[model samples]
Target chain A: MTDPDEAADRRLDANAAAGPLAELFTVDLTVAVATCAGCGNDAPLAAHLLYADAPALVVRCPNCAGVVLRYASSGSTLRLDLTGARLLTVTLAADGSVGISERQPHRPP
Target chain B: MSFVSRGFAGRRRKTPPGRLPPGQYDVGDGFPVLSAGPTPRTALASWDFQVQGQVDGVRRWSRTQFQGLPRESVSVDLHCVTSWSKFDTRWEGVSVDTLLADVVTAAEFAVAFSDGGYTTNLPLADLTGGQAWVVDTYDGQPLEPEHGGPARLLVPHLYFWKSAKWVRGLTLTLEDEPGFWETFGYHNYGDPWREQRYAGD
Candidate 1:
């Protein structure tokens, strides 16, 4: 029988999975730095493992496997959940105009 | 405005009836494996499942004991958050309802902890009422480790991520504690129909 673990590694990372969200953000999400809220681990979004087999994009922390972010789109409505991220730092340009966004706990809708 | 690579253009086909969900495509045959870490090899002799946390007390079952629990065969569609949906996948396992039948608890939520430290949270309500299972087999064969062999949680209603792989035991809690993916950015209440993929959604 084929090793299932090998099959899992065949999956894509956040960088490859970010194709859809590339249009929603001004900066490249793959290049952005993300700090995990759970373990406080820091890494580029590209380093996160991305499972993009469903309706939403699921990005998990490479260090702890905690979720770093999730995004879903339905027609004109888009939902982004970053509850597990402490902060996301994006370098807007090569010139280094940095943008930092803090993730807040989700409120009941 | 979506960019479609020349290679990806031909991958999509006509949607099948009631099989495809919004923002997802059919990946006909063969289950696609996705995991956060290397697959763990747990010997069946040492494998055990537990129910801990806010429950009256922890309940444990060895590989033999778990298999002794009543089992059922289930056929359901699996929708991954990454845009792939597989229809009519079949599995056999013990239902969460049966697993919790003897345990007593007032907890409103659960955190499913797995062998390789993978965790995912779910409302207690979602685990009951025939909504979920701890499956050990897929299509009459023992589930492969990468697909959460020995046992894995199966919550078919939400995205597949919510159905944690390599599951060992569940920790019931009075307060909602976000598990692995939930802590990062995945929606806490991952309802596929609502497309609640992120924190705010």
Candidate 2:
């Protein structure tokens, strides 16, 4: 088997950013669709790469590696920056479920 | 002049007295692995470290050549912007002074770039006078990829983000540049003692 530690070899879900993001949004952010400003590719916020090893959590667009969102806390204050995302929209799942659903076509309009 | 909640108590860590900087907690031997991007694994045969930009000329070294250079064993405290401070962590690598000894440069700023396109900016003075190193070993083991292996820049005095991991080269500039976190909201100069963890603070 290949070295399990090799980077650029594996990808992670939004589990890392989900917890911190949950505290901010009442709705599940994992199901939200973010259009990458860099390339205009649309993907779920959960499918994006969450670089959690740094001082702050950075969510990057997997398509172009553009930063989609950044969140950090300083003492009692929290800061969030979203410059790489052109648009953010919530997409509901089948059977009226919200998050963690299988990928499906985004709703019309 | 504040009132306390009826059943509330402040959250505090039982840290060893006076050892930790403000708002920091001792991790107690567990060196946490944190990264802003995916870990990069470079082959030693193709790996090289360089110091370029604003210097008289670029300096390059292959993995074998760098390993042959003089190195130092350092035991220093590491303070992360996330309020975690690891004390007396051991590392082995060549100092920035040693690496820049032969190079001629008048630049006052430097941007440490890593293999995975991660970059962190610092002052030229911060990289000199034995303040920083490009380390490859931690705790007597070849540094792991998850923790910036094959050699990562070590600048312990500042927040760990300034010490770019998977560090590959330094690009010096006359003007100070904002790095990954610095461009975000992280303090420009992360001094743990002063608790400069954010841009304003």
- Identify the leading candidate in terms of lDDT: 2
Which parts of model 1 are misplaced by more than 4 Å?
A: A1-109, B1-16
What docking class should model 1 receive? incorrect
The TM-score measured for candidate 2 stands at: 0.81
lDDT of 2 by residue, A1-109 (tens): 2546534434455556778887777777877888998899898887887777566787888777777888876557777788878999986666666745555433211
Best by DockQ: 2
Model 1 native-contact share: 0.19
Model 2 in CAPRI terms: which quality?
acceptable
Runs off by more than 4 Å, candidate 2: A1-12, A15-19, A22-29, A64-66, A89-109, B1-17
Native-to-model Cα distance after best TM-score fit, residue B129 in candidate 2, in Å: 0.6
lDDT of 1 by residue, A41-106 (tens): 888887777767534576778777777787767657766889879999776545565443432222
> What's the TM-score of each model vs. the native?
0.67, 0.81
- How would you encode candidate 2's per-residue C-alpha lDDT over B88-195 as one tens digit per residue? 789999999998998887899999998878888888999999899999999999998878898899999899989888899999999999988888877888888899
Q: How high is the lDDT of residue A89 in model 2? A: 90
